[model samples]
Target: MKVVRFICRILLGLVFIFSGFVKGIDPMGSAIKFGEYFSAFHLSFLGNFSLLFSVLLASAEFIIGIALLLGLRMKIASWAVFLFMSFFTLLTLILALTNPVSDCGCFGDAIKLTNWQTFLKNVILMVPVMVVFLERNKFSVRYKPLGEWVTLGILFTGILLVIRYCYFYLPIMDFLPYRTGTNIPKAMEIPEGAPQDEYKTILYYQKDGVTKEFTLENYPWQDSTWKWVDTKTVLIKKGYQPPIHDFRFTDQEGNDITDLVLYDTRYVFLLISPNVQKANTAGIMQAKSLADLCHGGNCAFYALTASPFSEIRNFTEKNNPGFPFYHADETTLQTMIRSNPGLMLIKDGTIIAKWSYREFPEVERLKNDILGYAVTYYREKRESLTKTILILTLLLTLAVIKILQLNFDRRD
Candidate 1:
C-alpha cells in the first residue's frame, strides 16, 4: 500500500507540474484559449481577466504538485489536488460529450489533444488521483518546515519570473509552427501525392419542371428527357493541411505580396500587430528606430496588421512607422506574435528570429553590437537545450531524494 501510494503520488505530481510549467511558460497562449472558452459560454465579461486567472490556476496546481512530491502539507495538498483532478475530470467528460470547443487548452500548445483524447487522459490520471486521495492522511519523516517552505517559495517565485520574462519578451521557448529557422515558402508547400480532398458529386436534373438528384454512378448523362440544371459538390472531409496556411500578406489594393516578401534575400523586418489600435506607440517608435538603421544596409522593414486599411493609412499618416503597411488575418497575426507590436526577422524565405516589443535592443546597441546579421538560431537552440537539461536534472534529483526519505521512514 505504501509503495502504491508513493508511485501514485509521484505520477500525479509529475502530471500537475508538467501541465503547470508549460502553461506558465506561455500564459498568453493559455489566456487566448481561455478567451475562447469565455466567448463560447457567453461569459465574455471575464475575457479581460483570463490571463490573470490562467496564471493563478497554473501556479496553484504547481504549488500543490511540489507539496505532494516533498510531502509538505500533504493533507491540504492531497485534498486540493484530488478536488482539482475530480473537477477537471468531470469537465473533460462534459467537453467530450458536448463538443463545444475542439481543444480544451489543458496542456497549452505544448501538446494538443482532441476532446475525446483529453477525456481519456483525464481518466488515466484519475487512477493515481484516487490513490492520493485515499493516502492523504499518511505522514512520516519529511523535509524540515523551514526548508520546505523556502524551497516552495523559490519555485513559486521562479515560475512567476519566467512568465513575466516571457510576457515582456518572446517566450524563452517558441513552440509555434513559425518558430525561428522555419522556411516560410517551404512550410506552406503541400507535399506531392498527399491526401487529396474527398468530395461527393451530385447532379440535379430538371425534367418537366421537376428537379431530381443523381449520384455520379447513377446519373443518366444521355437521357434525352432529362435536362441538366445544376451540379452540387459536397465536401466529405478535409485534405492535406500545410503547416503555414492563412499566411498571406496583402496591400491596400488587394495585391498579394507573399512571394515577394518571402523571396527577398536581404534581411527583412516584419512588424506584426494584430490590432494596430492596441499596439504600444513606444514599441512602434522602437521599430522605427530599428528601421532607420536598415536604410543604408541591405535590410528592409514592413508592417503587417489586421486593422482596416483606412485605419492603417490614418495611423501611418499620424505616426509614420517608416514601413509600408500590409494586411493579414487577425488570428494569424496573434498566433505569429502574442505581443501587440512584436518584431520578427526573416531572410531568404526563412524566419530567423522573433522578439517582443519590450526586448528590442536600443538603436546604438542594435547597430554596433547585434545588427550585423544576427543569427539567433544557434543562440536560441543552445539556451533552450540547456534550460531543458537543467530542469530535468533538478526534477530527477528531487525524485531520488523523496524515494530515499520514504525508504528511511519505512525502515524506522
Candidate 2:
C-alpha cells in the first residue's frame, strides 16, 4: 500500500508538472480558450482577464506538482491535488456534455484533445487524485515551514509573471488558430472583384544589419516564410490579383462588391463576425464601437457575415452600426479567425494586427501599437529566440533537482 501510494504520487506529480509546464508555455492559448467560454456566457469583461487567470492557474499546478513530488506537504498537497482534479473533472464533464466549444484546450497547442478525450483524461486523472487524497494521512511526511512555503509562493508568482510576459510579447507556443500559422493566405481569401493596386513591399531587416525589400511576387520561399513566421494572416498586396474564382457576393443594393479588400491603400478594418442573432450582445456592441472608431478615422470598416443580405441588412439597420455589411462564407470566416467576432487590421494590403473578440484592444489603445511597431516587432523576435532556451533551462533545473533528491533519499 505504501509503495502504491508513493508510485501514484510520483505519477500524479509528473503528469501535473508536464501538463502545467506545457500550458505555461502557451498561457495565451489557454486564455484564448477561456475567452471562448466567456463569449459563450456573454461575459466579455472577463475575456480580457482570461490570459492572466490562465497563467496563475498554470503556476498553481506547477507549485502543487513540485510540492507533491518533493513530498514536502503530503496532507496539503494531496488535498490540493484532489480539489484541483475535482474542479477540472467537473469542468471537463460540463464541456463534454454541453459541447459549448470544439476543444477543451487541455494541453494547449502542444497537444489537441477533443471534448470527449479531454473529459476522459480528466476522469482518469481524478481517480488517482482521489486515491491520493484518501490515503494522504497514511503517508507520514512533514509540511514545509512557513518560510519555505513563502519562498515557493514567490517562485511560482515569478514563473507566472515570466509566462505572462512571454505570452504578451512573444507567444512561446502557438496552439490557437490565429497563432502564426502557415495557411494564412489561403485561409483569408481576397475577393476577385476587389480593386488591384501596387504590390505592398516588405522591408526586411536581417540580423546581419542588411535591409532588403520583397514583394509577394518576388518573395523568396513564400511557403517556408509563411510557416517560419507562423503568420496567421497576411494582407493581399496591392496590384496583386487574386485567383479568378475569388467571387464577391452582392449586397442588398445589388452592388457586386466586397465590403473591404486587401488591395486598398487605406487602412481597412475587417470584422469577421458570426450571425448577429448567434453572437453575444456585448460582442455586437464592441463591434459597433469599433466601427464608430473606424468611421471617425475615415478608415474603411466592413462587417462580414455569413448570413443572407436581408438578415444582415436588417440587423445592421436595427443596430445602426453605421458600417457597411458584406457577406462571406461561414467556413471562410471561421478559418479566418477562431473567435466568433474577430477583427483584422490591414494597411496597404499588409496585415498589421488581429484580435479575437475577447482580446480586442480598444481603438484608442492601437495608437501605441502603431507607434511602437518596430519595438514590438523586435521584441517578438527576441522572445521567439529565447523561448527554446528558457524551456530547456526549466526542464534541466527540474531534472537536476529530482536527481539530487533521489541521491539524498538513497543516502538516508
Query: Which candidate comes out best when scored by lDDT?
Result: 1
- Per residue, candidate 1 scores C-alpha lDDT tens digits across 1-412 of 9999898888878888888888887888888888888898889999999989888977887888887776776777788988998898898898899878888888877888988999999999888888888878875546555555656776787678777867777676777778888998888889999898999999999899999999999888888899998999998887997878888999989999887778887778888988788798778877877777778675778888999988888888988877778899987888888788998888888887788888775567556535343555346656875897698669856854664454334323
* Alpha-carbon deviation at 39 in model 2, angstroms: 4.7
Task: Evaluate all candidate structures by whole-model CA lDDT and list the values in order.
Answer: 0.80, 0.66
Q: What are the RMSD figures for all models against the true structure?
A: 4.8, 17.9
| lDDT agreement of model 1 with the native | 0.80
Q: How many clashing residue pairs are found in candidate 1?
A: 0
Count clashing residue pairs per candidate: 0, 5
> lDDT tens digits, residues 5-100, model 2?
888898898887777887787675577678888987689889779967888778888888877886756788998999888888888888888888
Top candidate when judged by TM-score against the true structure: 1
TM-score of each: 0.82, 0.50
Following a full C-alpha superposition, what root-mean-square deviation does model 1 have from the true structure? 4.8
